[model samples]
Target: MVVESSPTMVTRSAGSCEWTLVAEDAPVLFPDENLAPKLLLERFSHDELKSGSHRVVFKLQTGNGCYYFKHYKISDWKSRLQNWVRSSRARIEWDHTWKLIELGFDTCLPVAIGEKRKGPVVRDSYLITREIPDSVQLDQFVEKVLPALPERTRRQLRFELARQLGIVTAQLHLKGVQHRDYHAGNVLVSWDETSLKLKLWLIDLHQVSFGSKLKTKQCLRNLALLNSYFSNRGNASDRRRFFRSYWQTFQTKKNGRPRGFQEYKSTLLTIEEFCDQKMWKEFARADQKWERGNRRLVILEGESEQNACRGVSELDRDFLKAVSQNPQNTFGLPLLNKSVSVTKRVTLKGEQGILSGYLTVCDKHSKPKFSARTAWDIGHAFIRRRLSTPRPLLFVEAKEQQWLVTEAIPNSMPLTDYAQSSQAHHLNFQSRRLLTRQLAAQLAWRDRCGFQDNHPTLFNILIQPDSDTFFFLGLGYLEQLNTPVSEKKIIRTLAAWTSGSLPLSGITRTDRLRFLKRYLLEKEGDWKRYWNRIDSKVHSVHSN
Candidate 1:
């Protein structure tokens, strides 16, 4: 079953550097064995497909057909030493591609490989493979193409795709191939329009290990990595279907018997545990993106020694410099609020074109340092939990004051304002109920993430009229809890939102009950008990 390609190797030297090229002898592409290396090395017309830190992928087109060229450059001593010890990345991928092909697994066809070395140290390497026509990355296909199809057709395609992925993954594990970076982006999905037949191919083979049986840990880790993308994009039922298919296929291959309900349940739980660990690691990585001196972020010192500003790399330095010098004077449009901090709406030009942001300046007596830092931390926390909030952009610290800049959410108004607007009257009963449910769900999710808002008034929340999306404001009032919020605290938050000087409009008793039901859906408590406590707290606050 293993058909090996007869590849011809050619070595060329220029000054003190050596170049080695090995190419498969395919008559259609490489008619001349020696010339194939020169052609690929010298004059192949290419368009860049993707570029990363150390690797650049190009799509090469010739008389034969389309091919992908993945070039890997070793810039650091660590990478050079690794390559010297275990050979180049191209060589590893070349071997792995052939093995996968021989095993009858769908993968890219490795055509040629080249390495540039000087005195046993590889400086650069490249791998060339025949491209799969009309194929897109699995993640892209799901996000872009699937939604455009008919509802019934999309469901059928998704089911088939999940089933096929499970089958292929199980076969790979049974054959002793473990893909370390087994995410959706590394997999390619292609489909026929006429018959709606789908095909999947695994690519990016360098990190994969061969001839090593997968242990439980290895299996769970790989599945978790794959699930990370789907966990956000697909629902729970989709994931359950995928896991069931995988379990059935793996069991059939290993023991020729189907797994029972308890066994499947146990396996699914283990997989979920691994997925949670993966998510935590991912959250840590996201947090690191905002660290000082990171490539994505920059810090700039102002002319005055006491003044300094930090912002995302894309922000224009001149804008940040102006804000660093005097933030209160930079934005003259005052925002309506009762806080002691000076808040204003500002529009600035940056590398990303025009940016509109809210600028808050806190003086020394108001603890500007703490205010700026807390706002920054809370903004990122909302992002980590996938909750909607204003994106924190820049922070300026000075001897007398500090400034924090956050992106302005477009087409949105404060929740209280939205409730009083004509838009509230336009909504039907069902729409109002849906909006209340969504708002309550967001609050519940925030609570589950161990965050509590000191002031849970409608004035601190924003709602977009068109999409009904909720965005939290007043980041300075947000706090992280060391433990779960107590029942008393939960009731107090509900009472604060309801019994403020300005009562929330358009919400009836029925709507309040709907909100409570949704908020308590995940909490471990009797709904009526929570409702009774909340009602008593609201009445007590009103009486006070």
Candidate 2:
């Protein structure tokens, strides 16, 4: 997917340094005459690299076997790499992590540091690190071996992997390292189909943080993300097994929260005495259900103290237990006793950098009366463009906190680099028209969906896999709904793209959903209408 730039994002890096746009889709060719560290590998070597994600990993095969060399981008947003000798907490976290790295942790350890670009000790610091060999990222492993693994191995691996991840993450929190992006991809594992080994390797370490006291809330949210990943792969029973270890390992640990909630009394946040006041939101006359947006749920043990679902009653448990015992269904998810789906105790991700599976729409638990229903409706329409343009409908379902989870699109490289960009760069004749048509299709969609009604200031388009595609995201701000004049601004943007054809302004959520219900579901505004579509999309995706 080739994403278009926002007027703001055209020349930027997440680390907040200026980026040099490639005039052509060729590899970067850093000069041979340049210094050894900067010119360690040819600029062309970067064609294999995805921009602004992993540390610069250069595979230079010297006469002595194969080795992967890494250098941190000097321009990272944190801008702390300029001084390695002057230790900040991030560096301390890095240093402390190295000190505490136990054996069997097959992570990329820092081999050395390239302290300067050409000058000494002032800027352009790089960490030279090794690669995790004979191992694959969990996502890659799933793509490659998941289908091939036997049912038993997959089942067992799910629970065991969750247990391992819980233990690892809990241990990290205990050590007071709050890894901002502690999702599945950051944690690497090596499995032989007999026994699996787990290793927690921090990736994209620019956002990683260190503090004397860990924020239990933040850590739990991070852990919830882990739960989402494993749950998607395994089943409910597997997730429960994972939580058993998590509660056992981390719950009783001392000094986990540095300044108690009492310390934050002055802040907007307040520790609540009542459970419902702190936890679940009552909406539509009830709390919400786990949506298809986040495909899986994480069961955090010892979470009873957190004012979430403690455990279901013995009768509910026995019924669920019997369902798991049934040979037809492996995971012991609560059954729909009636026609309606049962409300599930699930957790989702929120932070922007990492993939928070089916992001939960955020709100203030302290609000007098909260309803994410409007947020969900707005988000679903908005996130649609993202899922459509970058790829086809990869929509995540809506859940607690108004989360929308979708299955990942398969086999995509960043559109700016690699073969996709190569195919797109310097297009001759026929290709240009085709791409124009595709963009036209997207514009038609936005036009059909009516971008003008959106709150422009709150507008965000989250592009995926580094492409020109920008899917409109973030719709919590509702005041942007148009009057007669502002609606024209959006219409003009759509009109210009489509050569003056007027797309429906999509005046209301009801209207947008009417289109969605008809186009996707072949009906209007019903949950089953959508679920049937998803079941069809992932028909082959059954539990082992």
Candidate 3:
């Protein structure tokens, strides 16, 4: 049976069991009744477009033209039932492409669609669309093509492309069409030789949905997904121009230029805030779902965290035993507090440098209490909370021994090292003040987050050479207070800063008070009491 809806698109029945869609009266790609998608895939010369558990796509050449064939596979009863009720992905994409084209938007031309069903469930489905000729992905165009062009040409191309993108996005929103996966990879770019203009065609329409006039939050989400790419490739001014162009096109019939600075600023702020909030929520969810086993500690067996590390060892029982047994791999001297703390440095593949593993032991049997695994988890927590700290590489438990590996910070000295050295007196005045101010800000932030570091000391902070950035070393015992961090924790941290055993003995009460003002902000009496306590503690230690 055959049906020709258009000269380009043809729908026909293939053999005894298969339905097919193809271009220009072309023969069926799959003719065998016994053949499955996988077996059929191997017979053709094709480049894979995408391969996942649910669907697989390939760009293959046909007698008619180059076409993309996407095979949707149902692996389980749950997906089968859902797809059966909601319509197969193939039908959705095929219908959506036709609708979008009818709505005056460019998209890949659907050539054919097929579905092989079993009773009430769709077991397998396929969608075929003709490939756009002379097209490149927008990201690829930006990365490989734009940088090679002349400066003037590059600027003109970027501006024009951004303007066109703005127009299309505005059109999509105003028409109430929302692309769920609205990122750069789904957008295809082509240059028109005759018009001397650029054309864009959107793809991956299976998830596309239509609604009434899009709300501001919905529009912002779509914009943020697009902005994620531009934020990396384009400058602030470029992004601003893109948004401004979008607003102008959106308001073409409704209003003139922005009424005032405040309105314009508010729109920009909304976009920024929504984007940030959406991105953060995604990051947090990703972090939570990153592993399967324990939330705090998961054994790394070919997990992403292992691959993410620069010098990650192939974590296994034998590898852990080897690292635990070797002393040359150990950092610092051997076993003073054998049951308390131990560290080792492991070299990496290539010239990627080394990683250090520090373990906190608990008892005489060298059984760990807090453990290296805990430190690894806490390090990631701090990072997700936007605090600067050493990057944890891997954690492994072997023979009841635990190890945590972290990237080594180079050309850095502990804050205590700076305070104890002769260089302490000759330290740059601006550098010292800057470091102090940054420390105040970090402490204030910690307090706000209800964090109290029990071992707050100069030794716990590592200042990178000639940079405002610093890494917190004493994270193993970091605690979350049930209540907000009290004034006592603040005072205790400040007292550690003024501990007179080090070079800061030359610092006066006025200097301490001024430093406190940066964080405490106008708590003169509290600052005085904190300073007196610090002085009294130093005096008492000296008297003892």
Candidate 4:
């Protein structure tokens, strides 16, 4: 763990690219010719891990083993100048990783570092690290592998996993290093077949910070960052155990308690609040991206980015206008429970042969700007949020009339139609349970996006006839609340779902509660109270 000498740079004849060997151990293993960035670039493309704006990561297979190579590219003058005088991210990570290993923490071992410069500008750079063999991401292991184990084995594994992660996190804090992007995905857990214990290692160390012991706020932010990803994945009890184990280790390191009981409890609350606030911000940003006045979309529309007549291509604005002019021209079927809306399939001949789309002309309430344009924006919003809606192609405003053209979804049936079929009744109990659980989960997710549909029901959804996957069909009413959604909103949506789908779909009250339990990840005792309170509220509203 000692520095042999200063980092030596090798000038390669290929353009301005150069190789820097920081650790002396690298040259002894990887020959100078093979370590060239140009040679690495010429290697097969199949081992690529990821390509991003800042860097590209790939794995190189050799007789020895596999090595990870991350090449950083400076995209702008600002970044180029910044890295010219200073070490690149690859170098920083290379140095920090060695520091972590020297401190007796498990992390990826650095192999080599490379950079491509244009005169004084650092153009492209990369760092190489040896892969951690027989390891899987902590998140993937928890989601995919953990559930298949026996109950006793699973319980033991879960506890030990949490304890080890807690210990590592505490150790990092004690060493005054803050892993800014500390999430489950960044942590690797390797199992030893003989020892039956998991070894935890942290990866992606470029953002790792080193300083004096972290402040209270800094500690909370670090812990909150780690907890946020697991918020929905882990059950309340599992999360509580992890938090308790982490805090216990944290306090032990301080030789006593870090703060008074009340203060410490308040800190935990602060961490929860911080995590929730971050989640809300992400939701808000996503919600805003679909709004009518979104700057990017507006610019896109003005620029006529695609080959289309009348500032549109993929969708025919002229056809949409014709549909709006005379709705009766094409015979159409009416959507159930909705008299104002009508859908007719239309085909347009394009350069790519025949393209099928749906034209929906609906009557709108007499409100300012409440035209087809609004529905057009809302449809895009639904698609952006990954809701199951026909993708909107274009929105045409013809006088007071509204017309929306959308790409048609094939091989799908209305949720109501699917629910009443013999297929639904004949489905196995597990399939039925999975369908119900997914529906509840979607409702929960939509609620998180601040969508408060006044008449939420299975009738407003589309289901894949074979797979049973469902999509939200009624995007016209999905107005963005643009605020942090409350639990009450979710409860009300769940209530509507039960009232609308249960009677017709032959779903019993107990099965509905079971679905809710899975969505909420609630324990038996907690679920009972939650169901009672929500059920009472639903009944009171109906009776009134």
Question: What's the lDDT for all of these models?
Answer: 0.73, 0.39, 0.64, 0.65
Model 4 bad stretches (over 4 Å): 1-34, 117-121, 134-164, 189-200, 255-264, 285-298, 301-442, 445-449, 461-473, 482-492, 503-508, 517-544
Error of 1 at 74 (Å): 3.0
Q: List runs of model 3 lying over 4 Å from the truth.
A: 1-8, 15-17, 20-25, 28-43, 63-65, 191-197, 253-265, 291-544
Q: Candidate 2's residue-wise lDDT over 391-426, tens digit each?
A: 111121112222222223334333223213444445
Q: Quote each prediction's TM-score.
A: 0.71, 0.40, 0.56, 0.70
Tens digit of lDDT per residue, candidate 3, span 488-512? 7766776666674246543435445
Error of 3 at 383 (Å): 12
* Candidate 3 TM-score versus the reference: 0.56
Residue pairs clashing, model 4: 72-125, 308-313
Candidates ranked by TM-score: 1, 4, 3, 2
Screening candidate 1 with a backbone cut-off below 3 angstroms (N, C-alpha, C), the clashing residue pairs are none
lDDT of 2: 0.39
Which lDDT tens digits does candidate 4 get at residues 107-188?
7777676666667656777787777888889987876566545555666787778778777876777678888889888998
Can you give the lDDT of residue 510 in candidate 1?
76
lDDT of 1 by residue, 1-544 (tens): 1234545665544444344445332444445543333365355687887887688888877777888878898878888889878978888898898888878788877766677777777778878788888899998898568755665677788887888888887777667788998988899998875576788899998788887557676777777778766654555567777777777777765453223223777778877888877876776677666553577666776445747777777788887777766666666545423335666787776887978888877766664324676677778768766678988888877666667889998898888777767888677766787678778878886775667777677678888776667888777767777465667778888777766523546656777778888788767888899878877887876778
Q: Which of the predicted structures, 2 or 4, would earn the higher lDDT when compared with the native?
A: 4
Question: In model 4, what is the error at residue 122, expressed in angstroms?
Answer: 4.0
